[model samples]
Target: MPNGCDDQLPNRLARGGYSMRVRFQVQGLLLVLGILLSGIALAAKAPVLGEQLEYTLKFRGLVTGFVEMNIAKMTMAVEQEMGRVDENPAIVTDLHLTTEPYRKAEMIYPVRLHYRSWLDADKLHPLIAVKSLKTREEKEELLWFDHSQGEAYHYQSGELQAGSNSRPPKNLQGITALSDEQWENLLQAHQVSIGGIEALDYISFLHRLRSMPLKSGKQINFSTFNGKELNAYLVKVDQERLVRAGWNRPAFRVRMWEVDSESGRKGDDMVDLWLSDDNERLLLRFYAERAFGAMEGILETGRPTGGKDEGFSEATRSSLETYLGF
Candidate 1:
């Protein structure tokens, strides 16, 4: 529970178990999603369905786990329901983090975390988000956002015996209007306010960052709810670098920090990321510093489904090259 990123995972990571640390580290890569910005627009397009990426999580130079991200087409029913509010179809994003436990740690501890979000294709706002996590226990969480009605709902199933191994729920639950009891609980928990500041869930926030116009020295302000408290964050586009992910690729280095909503001061939870400097905006590398050792995420393989508008146009590429003095 350090820094209020998540309730369970961080506490488990703090135990200093190698396997748990690695799993926590892998999830940490995605935890950075809670620490990004909102607003401002560019000509960036949303990630196309079928885009797949795989990453290797390392702790102290040792491979400990793997993270996979994918974009899948949404069901027609779900798309139509969202279409009632907006004309755009919903994009479904999936994230899977599994431990590659070393030193026979798998037998001792096995961990897997799966997260999925349904986001507006045009607005990039989350319609629904769900995650199933497995460590020594299994738990599931679901968050539903009704922008039209200006209501948000959070449901935690506590613990389930067969939840983690099961697939994400196909049926959209909690789509109804917030009941009186639900409203009272949300107000007490302060997960998010209906008409308050725009707060995206973890997955939508990450995709929102991809849609932003990323230029070096740029800073953006945003807020997100981590299935717990709603916290503000700031992200700075630090610089561009040539990162080696299978090959040398131009990438933008971005750093994220938590900001106090009242004081507007920065917190200690920091995350660093390198995203490919192109329309695709692939995550090239990431590193997070923990109270114990640090965890690093390296792109092992990236396979885009070759959709339209994949990378920078020739003119844009040349312009960037001239600007960077390449």
Candidate 2:
């Protein structure tokens, strides 16, 4: 009986130790999982605020303009007629494109265009977009997108003469304050409606590209509303190594083209874009053939580190400029 009691004592001790081990293992796993989740949340929120990208615009291998892209935090508040207010945390992106003064390309038609897009931070859907242009004449246009109703409202301030055309209209202080009847009257000719699930404008489309999962050999399709009409695009993605501004990096080469709005047939206007294959997904290079000639935009200061190059021989550049009447 003494020997049997001693055996049961060891068995009980062994069971107690095993139970403690199992508890410790589970606690360790939970701690690690919590840490991983926290890390992911921080990473997702860190790089989004106050980020800016500057690009140098080149036409026929000569620096002609500059482009600036900025992202910032915003709050979108919309008040309905019944005193109900919808406030949403939002992200606002601003893109400014300006031609260098007295540059050969600017001699013909100078351009100073500013665009802003307000988007829902969580869903990445656009809420409003503003287009301000200063070419021969200055004009400003605003587009307020209502995805809930699948409609977009357009407002324009005619031509802002000379004095009052400096800054954009204050946010939510203008068109959003109008009533439904006022908006309906304002939407007579400028009413733009979604033809598909959703439509993005120029600025929102660029922001969407950054948030998308771009993998090699992937094809993405979407529609864009360019103030007047709905344009569909099919984009093809491929991974490639690109060299620019003395920096060579792996990039996602995206080729985009338009499709027929009605038939979905392939159309014209092919544009090529290169984005860094990193967490930031920077726009390293942009190439589009315009009516004037081939226009290109490269990162002003390349990723990681960068150095500048003229990208064309002096004689070749001179000859091309002369031919293009620059």
Candidate 3:
């Protein structure tokens, strides 16, 4: 992840392959959708189906990327080994991310990534996550979550579709590309075991977190799948604060990190986040210590699904300026 796009995964995901990617090329898109998008029906503690949060991506001090979330009526088609399931009355989230040319760093052309997620209407479990990416490189990933059977399905685009710049490591033993006649057989869905893990894809993790009671000094731990590996994560409620966050609402200062419970050694990546202190629990701001300096996401503008822009309070803007050391 360090070499690739600094995707919206746990800050640790940055240690992967490529300079242009910090996140999963496919589910980095999927992760952001889960991490930031919300559903409308479940109540205020979780994201409403019609709510959308727009964010600005900053690296060091540059506004290099933009990401936005929009949740609408759930109407996407999803299929699994079991069969097709009707997602009517489901919750759907769409995410879009774009980055400007980092010409000075050899990252010339801009990049765009798109992701979609569908969740069950009542339980809010992830049904499927789909990703599409295009830049100097082309990659796609799709995820199927069948929690009922405790299984996960994954797919990564074959190298044939890989951009001239990216040659994904071969998972086919010593074989790389297969003949066209054998292509369909070669490109098969890979499976990861998640039978007992309470795993949430990147996007759905936030929803799960929102549903928790983050009382002061409480610690929450869970397992999450970042497509490739299933890792454990910890979210602790460090304390509560009275910052206005530009609005008059109170906020909670929380700490998040990865942990190896067996060894008890902490992870290198760390995240400090601010969430609304009320039932809404919006993720107001976060600063992640990643390989490439601090990756910051600030709320720029947002609205409920089908609603108009709900402007950010100037105080929130000023707080960001001060927090970023502007």
Candidate 4:
């Protein structure tokens, strides 16, 4: 009996050593360490605010292992809030990309988001205009839209409509007709003009950080226009190279670490954004974990062809300036 018990003990010990639980523990530990190291590296490169920046944004979406959708080109401009500007405004956003099908059709489109600000009573009001230009058979269809008072206005050909409307009046025919809801949906799906308000918030946060004195580990909370709060940790501050997602636009380089609250469900929901070591005026890169996998955006800058400057008004500029301290 004693010999039988001793023999069984060796087999039990061998089985326990190779258990699935043990293997899982090892993998989980490694994942945690990797995440920690990433945070540490980011902290070491945090930048101070108020630095001039220029960079480009490149967008690539992978549909399969070999299929990719490459956007043409994207550009961004960043400047410190001059007086009372609260948000970092996007001076220009030019999108140039071509979509290639697996075997057939390919299409190219140009999208632009231009902004200009002036001065208001005690705040800096920003006016953003989005334009999309598509050419077909020697005919160019130019479309424009603006957002105001929780509604968007569409101006194309020679007609205008207000509110959550999409199509212009029947009387205003032959013009490119698009509703606010439709345009918004298209941009969101294609991830174009995705950074409009978010980019503004990023700039405002940078300005605030720039004005503050340097510290080892400083944390700040920022709320977006949509009421989402993001927490930023100031790990390191100084000058560094910052890269963003676009085609050929200039991007500001800065050092910063921000953790944004997850919008949807709970489990492992977070969006992490990092600026380069230099304190330019734009976001360098952002990483988020979605239900499927991890996704990221890198800024690429480029030059724009000659076009009209349909930007913000002087009165709106005054309002934004007063509000943001530009």
lDDT of each: 0.56, 0.53, 0.51, 0.29
Model 4 stretches astray by more than 4 angstroms: 1-62, 66-72, 78-216, 226-268, 279-282, 292-295, 299-326
Number of colliding residue pairs in model 2: 0
Could you estimate the TM-score for every candidate? 0.65, 0.64, 0.62, 0.33
For candidate 1, the TM-score is: 0.65
lDDT of 1 by residue, 1-326 (tens): 01112234334544666565555644554454323212222335576667776665544312221211121111111122332223547777777766543323333345577676788887788887666677777766667776766666666653333433332223353332334442222211223565766878867777788777877778988877676667788888865554332435557777888898899989887888787777777677776655443455666564233323324322233434544575
Write the residue-wise lDDT of candidate 2 on 1-326 in tens digits. 00011223324434545435433432332221111001111111212656676665544311221211111111112212111114765666666666544343243345566666667766666777766667666666667777777876666655334443332234454534544443333321255778356787755566678667677788889887656666678898888777655557778888887888689888676777887777677677766553333444566543455445435523234545665565
Query: lDDT for model 4, on a 0 to 1 scale?
Result: 0.29
Rate residue 98 of model 1 by lDDT: 65
Model 1 clash count equals 0
Q: Which is the winner by TM-score between candidate 2 and candidate 3?
A: 2
lDDT of 2: 0.53
For model 3, residues 1-326, the per-residue Cα lDDT tens digits are: 01123334333333344334532332233243333312122224645656666665544311122212121111211222121235334456667766643332223234567766666656666767666666666766666676777877666666443333332224321222234333232332456678877777766666666666666677778777666667787777755443322433346666777889588667876677777666777776655533333444555443223433334323334435656564
Candidate 4 per-residue C-alpha lDDT over 152-254 given as tens digits, one digit per residue, 9 for 90 to 100: 2223332233342343233222222335443333321111132333222333333334333333243444332211222333333333223222222322223
TM-score of 4: 0.33
Ranking of models by TM-score? 1, 2, 3, 4
